[model samples]
Target: MRILLTNDDGIQAHGLRVLYKAFREAGHDVHCVAPVTEQSAVGHAVTIALPLRVKEFKENGFRGHGVYGTPVDCVKLALSALLYEKPDLVVSGINAGANVGVDLLYSGTVSAATEGAFMGFPALAISYDDFNHEGLTGEHGSYVANLVERLPLDNLPHKCVLNLNFPNRPVAECRELRICRHTSAMWEDWYDQRHDPRGRPYYWLTGVIPPEKVSADTDRALLTAGHVTLTPLRFDFTDYDLIQSLGGSLE
Candidate 1:
């Protein structure tokens, strides 16, 4: 299968590099086009008015293209220009941090794969829940490689993308891959106010998940308990249930 690899953690991220090698070793053709800088929470944004640049990416002998734009731009350009043909699958991540629950709405890693899904291709978005970066090339990498190689890449379910998050535990400590729903997670956005030397005000954004928002059986909570989580994501944002329940009040 021709697998396209991308990430929000720029082109030279350790997570991306490990996957590149692992996937190739597993006998799949891999291509990469990723943001040239860290784009962690950029979400599903795409470059429109700005002139995007694409250049050769080379580091530690791995070669791919680097896009000077968002993760969605990388996916768009790679499909339209870089690859000779449409890929069998588009895989995003091995991201620097877990993109679970509400992070789904703010993750560029998932956005790249989401863009691929919008373009009518099968996509997978994965992340290691640990932020310490110790598991980039260990069990987490192997688990992802195996999952990709075994997937029905040519015939994925239509109009949905898979979101996978692995726990921060060791390989042997992992319980199982649990197919689950997203947790009702919310971040209490906090700002650290500061002033520049010249007296201009600034604020650093910070977030803390409230205890009330924590649920027992969500991807986010399950992952912390040593289970890998897989959730199916859909793009249809319509509140159809509400619409259906609301009877016609006026013509």
Candidate 2:
């Protein structure tokens, strides 16, 4: 299968490079178009007011185009201008951090795959639970590539995204992949206010979901339990039940 590979962790990220090699060795044609620098948590932002720049990167037999813009921008630019043909699949990440629950709302990693789905292609976003890259290896990428090679891409619903998250442990240690749902839980977020050299206050964002809030059968809980989690997501944002109730009342 032809694949468009991208990530929010920048083009030169180890996880992205590992995935590139894995896909190539698996015999799937892969193209990498990703951010020139880390663009994590930027969500689905696009460069509307500024001209985007693309630079080709080739090193140690790995090649990819790096975009000086958001992860979503790379996918849009690649499909609209770079590639000679549309890809069969758009895969993002092998991200350093997990994208689960509300993290998906603020994740550039998942947003990249979401952009690919918007273009009517089968898309996937892969992430690891560990942020510091502890215990990560090529086997994780190979495992995911093997799964992608077997997925029924042609039959996937339009505008659907398969969000895959692997546990921090090695592939051999993971309890098989489990299909799950994202939790509706919100993060207990807070801002850390501090002073700069000039005595100006700056706020740094930090948060976590309380353990009691995560339930079993959801992506977060399963991943914490050392299982790979796959959650199918759709772009349709309509609250149909609410819409139906207010349909004629507002009319």
Candidate 3:
């Protein structure tokens, strides 16, 4: 299958390089168009006013492009300008950190794949839970790459995107992948107030310690237990149940 790869991390990220190599080695036609600089937490934002730039290159026997825009811009440009035809699939990430819980709201990685889904393509956003985890070299990248190659794309739901999160453990220690739900979790926020050398006030954002809830089916809980969590995400955010309860109040 022809796969278009992208990430929130910049074009030079180790995660992107490793995943690109793996896709090539697996004999799939892979094309890349990622941000020129890191665009993490930019959400599903696209470049609207400014002109976008695309730079084509070849590295490690893989042909790819770099985009001077957000992750959503990369997807839009690849579909409209770069590829002669739409790719079979769009895969985003191998991200630097996990996009779980409400964090998905701010993830550029998820946004890229979500953009593809909006355009009627199968999309996936893969991330590792560890922030400091390095590239998919030797066994690490290979294992995840192989699993991705074998994913049951043919049976995927329509208008849905997959959000995959792997445990932070070594590849060998990883258990089987688990289909799970997005955790009903949220960050306990805090701020550190301080004065600068000139006595100006500033605040540094921070979070309180996360507590383990009793839920048996959350992406975080699964990952914490060494499972690869696969959560199917949909664009529809409506509260349908509530809508029915308030049916036609004026009537």
Return the top candidate by lDDT.
2
- Report the lDDT tens digits of candidate 3 across residue range 1-251: 78899999978877777778777778878889999899988998988999999887776565679999999999999998898877888989889888887677889999999899888888989888877756344455576568766878777777788998878877778888888888877878888999999999999987732756526688888888888888999878899987887787645
**Pairs with backbone N, CA or C atoms under 3 Å apart (clashes), candidate 2:** none
Ranking by TM-score: 2, 1, 3
Which ten contiguous residues of candidate 1 have the minimum total lDDT?
Answer: 242-251
Ranking by lDDT: 2, 1, 3
Q: What's the TM-score of each model vs. the native?
A: 0.93, 0.96, 0.91
| Cα RMSD for candidates in order | 1.8, 1.3, 2.1
Taking the tens digit of each residue's C-alpha lDDT, what string does model 2 give over 107-170? 9999999999999899999999988875679898899889997888999999999999999898
Which one wins by TM-score: 1 or 2? Answer: 2
TM-score of 1: 0.93
Count of steric clashes across candidates, in order: 0, 0, 1
Q: Which regions of candidate 1 fall more than 4 Å away from where they truly are?
A: 244-251
Steric clash pairs (candidate 1): none
Superposition error at 237 for model 2 (Å): 1.2
Q: Kindly report which residue stretches of model 3 are placed more than 4 angstroms away from their true locations once superposed.
A: 60-62, 135-138, 248-251
> lDDT of candidate 3 vs native?
0.83
